[model samples]
Target: MRVDIWSDIVCPWCYIGKARFERALASFEHADEVEVEFHSFQLDPSAPEEPEPLLSFLADRYGMSTDQARETDAGAGANAEGEGLAYTSARKNANTFDAHRLLHLARERGRQREAVDTLFRANFGEGADVFGREALVGLAEKAGLDADEARRVLEEGRYADHVKADVEQARALGATGVPFFVIDERYGVSGAQPADVFTRVLEKAWEERD
Candidate 1:
């Protein structure tokens, strides 16, 4: 079974969804046979190249007060805690285009999942500057990838097309949100669902394999 997940790095729910999906996979009888791929999807492609206060960006984007946005962040943080993710509020917003390109680079080295988890933790847990080249190279190294290769990939603007293709594929698949899970490209699960839901989907996909 293959599961392709479309999600953004800075997305709160996507982190929670990843934990839940991991839990499901852990208990799956066929876990060893399952293949999971994480795809690129930018929640804000037009977001500023410079980092900005997360609270301010949320407030402006949703037309809500800063307090409301903070409250929302707190809510997401609490949910993340339930899954041991320890998510923190966004202190800075970053353009994830380069991050997505780095993801493709990591995928090429067969460390895509590790890169995904590392990037999520760095951005959401540690509030690292994911948009910066230095930070990305560090994250890539942490994921067991070559730091120099990662730097070259970012420098040469490599894998940018792969990121674009993933985004386009998501749009063509009628997805309008992050954390969208496509099971064998046959079933779609949206949002951060419970582990049971993913487990059920896994079973169903296993039964209907072609």
Candidate 2:
């Protein structure tokens, strides 16, 4: 089975959804037969190139106080802890175009999953900027990709079209939000659903495969 997941690195729910999906896959009987791919979806494509505090962005966008935004983020962090993920919610929201481009490069190197995990960790678990070129290079290396190659990919803007195409496809598929999952190109699972939901869907898709 092939599972293509469209998610943004800055998306909190997407990170949580990944953990839930992993748990479901771990319990799947045919886990070894499954291939997971991550695609690009920007929650805020026009996010500033210069860094800004995540709390300020949240408060300004949602018309909430900074404390209220922090409270909301803390609640999400607690949920991430349930999945054994260390989420800190103290990072800045960045333009993820280059990060998405790196993921495409990682895919060619057969390290897409690793790249996805690293990006999520950088933006969520640790207070790292996924948009910074140096930071992206470090994450690429951490994902088993060549650091120099990763730098070139970002510096030269490689795989940019692939990132755009992924976002376009997500829109065409009626995905209005991040963390959309497509299984076997036939089954579409949306949002950060429960692990059991993913498990049952995985089984159903595997069985329906012809």
Candidate 3:
């Protein structure tokens, strides 16, 4: 079984969905046969590389007051914790192009899953700035990737097309949000659905294959 997940680094639901999916995989009898691939999807394609503070960005975009933003943040933080991700004050959204590049490198090294997990932890758990080149290189290094090679790729604007292509493919596949999962490239499951939902889908796919 193959699962291709389209998600963003800063997406709270993606993190939660990841955890849920992991749990589902663990519970599945044929876990060892499952292959998971993480694909890139930017929440704000037009967002600047260095945007304003997340609160301000949300406030302006949604026309919400600062207080409302803060309240929402608190609620999101609690939800993130429930999903096993720690949320801190250091959280901010940065341009994820470089982060996506690092992910591409991880795929080359056959460590894409680890890279994705590290990226999510850095952005949501530790509140690291994922959009910065240095931060992205650092995360790649932590995930056992070659830091120098990662930097070179980012500096040279490599894999930008791959990221864009992935986004376009997701759109063509009718994915409108992050945490979108395509099972066996035929079944689509959106959002951070419950583990039971994922388990049921996986079982159905496996049964159909057999």
Greater lDDT among 1 and 3 belongs to 1
Models ranked on TM-score:
2, 1, 3
lDDT of 1 by residue, 96-170 (tens): 899999999888889999999898888888887888899889989999999999999999999989999999999
The pairs that clash in candidate 2 are none
lDDT of 2 by residue, 62-103 (tens): 999999999999998988999898888678986888889999
lDDT of 1 at 163: 96
Those runs of model 1 whose alpha carbons end farther than 4 Å from true positions after fitting are: none
Q: TM-score: which is higher, 1 or 3?
A: 1
Q: Local distance difference test, per candidate?
A: 0.91, 0.92, 0.87
lDDT of 3 by residue, 39-102 (tens): 9999987777984677777788899997888787887687778876777645786667778877
Give the range where candidate 3 is weakest over 10 consecutive residues by summed lDDT.
Answer: 86-95
TM-score of each: 0.97, 0.97, 0.95
For model 1 the TM-score comes to 0.97
- Whole-model lDDT for model 1 versus the true structure? 0.91
Q: How close is candidate 2 to the true structure, as a TM-score?
A: 0.97
Question: How many clashes in each candidate?
Answer: 0, 0, 0
